[model samples]
Target: MAGMMRRSLDAFCITFWITVFLAAISSATPIEPRSNAIQELWSSVRTLVFPPTNRCKVYPGDPEWPSDDVWMKLNKATDNRLLVKPQPQASVCYSGPFYNAEKCAEITPVWGSSYTHIHDPIEMMSPVAQGMTCLPPNVFDSHNCSRGGFPMYVINATEPKHVQLGVDFARKTGVRLVVKNTGHDFLGKSGGKDSLSIWTHHFKQIDYIEKFEDKKLGYSGPAFKAGVGVQAFEIYKAAHEKGRTVVGGEGETVGIFGGYIQGGGHSPLTSLYGTGADQVLSFDVVTADGKFVTANSTSHPDLFWAMRGGGGSTFGVATSVTVKAHPEMTTTASRFSFTSKDIGNETFWAGVRTYVDYFIPNADAGTYAYFLLLPNVATGIFTFSMSPFFAPNKTLEQTQTLLQPWFTRLNDLGITFDPNITQFDSYYEAWRSSFPLEVVEKINATTGSRMFPRANFETEAKREELYQNLRKSSENNRVQVHFNIKAVDPANADNAVNPAWRPNILFAQQAVRWPVNATAAQILKIRQDFQTGDMQRWRDISPGAGSYLAEADRLEPNFGQAFWGTKYARLLRLKTKWDPQDVFFATTSVGSERWKVESVDGLPNENGKLCRVR
Candidate 1:
């Protein structure tokens, strides 16, 4: 078997992936051949690290045509086609020392080692985990680039065997293998420095949509693998064409099954059905040991329990997610803007408090909602971007009545409620029409901070005031700031996803787009300003306030409370259980504190970041 494997590999690509499998290690131990599955696995990894022309190709008749026989045989044949090669004498290095022009030259054929179209790291991080542009400025720019600093490694996985091989490789290399689809991270946890990300972005296969048979449920959706990249709008649009709708992302561009749903996603139909995450039927995941598994209520129950809301990138890499899709029905879309600077801050605050107090108890849990408190200085008008998409089985008047107070008070305050309203057939068309999916995608890719699901809406007036102070902060600086709120109802108590999911009421707040850039000095001010404002807001609101770990800052300490809060300790055990070697890691990833102390074996490697798997 060994001789055959060697001869076959040499005939193919001269040890291509075998070199990666070998080069991945720092040692020169003799190689050994094993199962044919191992052979196919290496076949997939090569094209990924050093892809040729057509990167993401779909297998004929689909990979899982009958759910039993996938692309296993084809993958094996392809593996035989691409011969493995020897590793380069020296290890590949990312452009370092903050401006190595020669190293940057090494970055040519940019995607030479990349799996996606990344001219820079920012494109790679997306909005969730933007690269720190304090110095050289191009957050994504890398000389001789191999690292996205986000640890995103696209795996060209063909079969379950390939997935296991990738997992084994990551385990051996001490690289955290978080999964990704379309790189739509609201918080930057998916990719990080000192991490090896297994990007599912290339895995675009959708097996089947076993339509709901229960007539009473009136629900029909797809049982999809997480690799599907077409957005909620794409699938919903297709479903709409077929008289079906799935609860999914508002923007047509957001990846449907990627981290969004798993991380608690919301969309236009949210008001009607609930969050995209709530509609999940099951998750197809690859565990820490490289075994393929399904997570729900019964299988690997603890994992099922964690993936729901444990909020850890290290939990597992999910390939497919079966989600609930809904039918396209009539929907009303309206934009309510408040055109009055005379709308005193006090009045606005009181109105917000009243609205929260009133709606938190009665606003239908499934109703999608939000209210933006903005003072448009140009028009001497204080405006709010408040739009409530009417849920199915509900009327515009009924939604108006439920949320009437929010507008009536302002009307009484002498502001006209002349808002723009539109009605559409499919729930998605309306939401997709209004949301800047392109802009959102542009921004969503860069959103790095994650906000844990908030069960309640209660923050001091000071927080609002601080936001109001944002205009002041921007008054002298070059960067501008904005904030948004995502109000979500609590998941069913029986939900086994994450205990934090129990915080039925949740909201995400963000302030981004600093005043300056193009210069290190300008970038520093922008970063400092963002940090200062963020810290002040937290300190003023709740000095111990916690946010999502995905988009948290690289240097913010004491995140045990802020990111994980009460569940910090338990996540540790889970981390230990799955990643005992600390193979899966990020520079400041959640569970790495345990390994911060020097290892009895040696000093930290050049990476400075720990590599337990090493």
Candidate 2:
């Protein structure tokens, strides 16, 4: 009798699923009907037997999780490019099945560098975002290495179709999805737990288009269509070879066509040629419905506007982008440093005040200054290091002339420092010589940033206030300042970048780092102090100003307004329209407030199951 009942139930289930599947196919769109119907039927059947209480995304152990057969089918669909059950890059450091002492020793030395992580399929440059679960084994701890927040599987996507296949599979299977280009994401957006990742690091195609014309936008110039995997140095070199230059980030390994431009990339060339987003001609992206489309001023204008600075992994996956290229020009580079020990604290801060006062004039002169202000509490010393201040289209004498007033002021203040200024014939040469390789893998540090507008430097009182706040903020933290002001073009002002950036004169970041192997409570305290204490000082001064979304505090409050400002509403609307199902989830991105990552032990972490809150 039991067998008879079981047979009857099975028959009923099959009949119900077939009816639902057929109905779905009839109502579904032409592009996704058959596959959608099958996936819906499978999910419906699983829900009937084992219902989920939270309506959360399917986890690996859940009954609704895609079967091995389903993953196999996806692999076959992608032409067998799927990488299943991949281990973390640091897995070799631990006693694991893939352990190797020689390989571990070799990797351990360069493990902290961004170069080591950029080429990896799933490794992230920011280890803290990955929960620091698997790192080179240190003497302080004996924790076992795990995947942590890294994706469980990856699609080594060499083409757009592979990306489409990966997106469709994740959407259909109710699994988390993430897109990784160079793993250079600082906010953990490129990695997620129990996710199926689309690895776009192999999209290394670069084509230069001469006399590219866009009638709708009235753009006719030299442009380069770079693949998703193209890095800053690669594009810079390519453009230099063609006797042209492109606006890009300072970091050599930063992906240009992906997150950099999408987040309104600020560059040493920004003051001269506008932002990286402003230079964009078009983007080839795979939207939420797994449809590949090109977004430009003429076609899909809204998507184009949003894609320019809407932040990455929110609207869609970008496959390639065509960006404007400018004629190669000369650049003047300067490097100098002085410590408070040389001059008293009063004189050092006075020098800083003079430097702050020159921000507006520097912006007017189209100069980009990148420097660091580090104050050590224990040693009672303040160190100011200007690795290289970049001035484009200016000769060495012209650059020095611009800085003569500041130099005179320093001399009067009894501050002795050498201005190691030099000139390069090309922007690429100056960039190569000026900017040092950025160090990554700061697992214990938390950062917050602010964009200071031109008004902050207008009056002596305002300048004094800015200097005081900066000094107070740097008392217990490190401050990295970039005097990169955007030269906004009226034609491209409709992008979704933080509006505060338009009139901004400088961007300042405050960072706090704790010792390695700090306790969870200690780490929490450090992060809290950095946010509420150090960053709050900047926030109090810049009331209406916003921060650069790409390099901001991960747990920032009111992130929408902080990142997008007045544009947040429109960006959210576009996000809903393009990705209604919320298939994409990046930390602090548009429409992300509706979802939450269930962190472990009351600490902020992405290494947990993501679920909808509403």
Candidate 3:
């Protein structure tokens, strides 16, 4: 079985790249030469970088579609594992092409949940990716699923060689390339138009190294090597069974070592330890040049630093990551909330403002809280912010004592509340109880966020201004605002993560959800408003502060300053050195500003091409 699997995987990659190479050669276009030394020199560079080919891509409806012989050869190469499944847009939508309205209606109710979407390897839970270009904006509109915003083909990559093949094929053939692990990206980075995607969902492997040591970094500890397909829950479970714990996301389905850690992941453990990127020991990756290399503090050190927090799909395809593991500890868990009976009530705002003010102190006390503020228009009251927090190495009584001040402030303001606090003997237990509640179904929403430093919570005047602006913007736009309170100090472990994370006590996020029937202009306006209006308060309150790129505003102005801060310039230079021909491009990545997705009538069309700005 092992030999068969190996041969099948090998054949799949070999056949796929061979077909791409043949396609490129068949599609070559004749160019008129300028007949000058300078032009010829430049032409040589261009040809070396982007080899011209006529048969590179077999687009739908193209005359050069693969013949039966070609299909049989490719199938034999892959041991009949190559997949040609089109986008399943219609499977869950009433407007989808294959299903009747009645049957589609039946599927919609069950499929509308976030769990259902995340379970599928390809479907993006949010309608944004689904409706970006092809599917009708209206979820209920009857239409056939179109491959407008999705990849034209996908290779089910189960090994590093498959990834290398996809990367080399894309570079050599001049076709767009994307990597998908769990398809849980917030910005739809996993999808691209007329692109070839390498799906690493099948690459599930976990190995633990006892007394793992890196001689160059002068460190030694226990570490777990997680494959690209591994999720947070899997690692947490495996680590726990081995008498250890790992730093990971709150979501159960989130890919741990994939894009999460690459974007400088934060967690309840961040306050006590450091950012997720700080736990990295080594990474096994396939570079753009089709070489599989192990990057660590000693080898390919620059690539190691960049991949830690620089953002995904910009450098190369990561196959596995070995991260630090900490000893397991007990935790105190609590969930708190207070709802106002009257909307815009002065007393409610004052009390909530006081709670917000305590964010810094809470983190300093080794508590991590995931909180959200919601205004209840129907009840004419605020559905006060909710916080599910966990304190490590703290008893139930100590945890309650730490939280008593905030409760007193709420009581002083005559606020009502029902708080659920509990104690767990282990970190894993505390996580399983509350983290599941964090799951969200995909919606038509766009987020804008900021990292609020200690200064924002230090002064009373600043606190008042921050809360007032937050309330105004959130209430005015009917947006939901959230905060992740974590006091992170990386202990001088240098990497490409935004410098703003080091001093920040609160990570603030605001999201605007649009109506399904809204016009393109309205949607665009909402997107624009998120940057200028909705996020204005965050920008004003935290000037020079950056955001977490994994979930920040997509249309962020001066994005380099907002996402990477002073690190952007260095990241750009490294990007050129690693991928000089720009083999990979994801929206809002390190060097994405140089390209634009094709748009028509002031809105992006799914069928339009992604062209270089120059």
Which wins on lDDT, candidate 2 or candidate 3? 2
- Candidate 1 residues 499-605, lDDT tens each? 33334332334444433324434544555565566544444434334554443454345656555566667767776786554545433444756443222222111
lDDT of 3 by residue, 9-90 (tens): 9798767656655564344321233234323322322332233333233333444443344433333333343455455545
Q: Which parts of model 2 have CA positions greater than 4 angstroms off? A: 1-54, 139-142, 490-492
Clashes of each: 58, 0, 13
Return model 3's CA RMSD, one decimal.
10.1
Lowest-scoring 10 consecutive residues by lDDT in candidate 3?
A: 40-49
Error of 2 at 333 (Å): 0.3
Instruction: State the displacement of the C-alpha of residue 573, model 1, in Å, after optimal TM-score superposition.
Output: 1.8
Q: Using lDDT as the measure, what is the rank order of every candidate, best first?
A: 2, 3, 1
How well does model 3 score by local distance difference test? 0.71
- Work out the TM-score per prediction: 0.64, 0.92, 0.86
lDDT for model 2, please. Answer: 0.82
Q: What TM-score does candidate 2 reach? A: 0.92
Worst 10 residues of 2 by lDDT: 45-54
Q: Tell me, by TM-score, which candidate is best.
A: 2
Q: Which stretches of candidate 1 lie over 4 Å from their true place?
A: 1-122, 125-153, 175-178, 190-197, 207-230, 268-275, 325-329, 336-362, 371-383, 387-393, 438-491, 494-508, 512-545, 550-557, 586-614
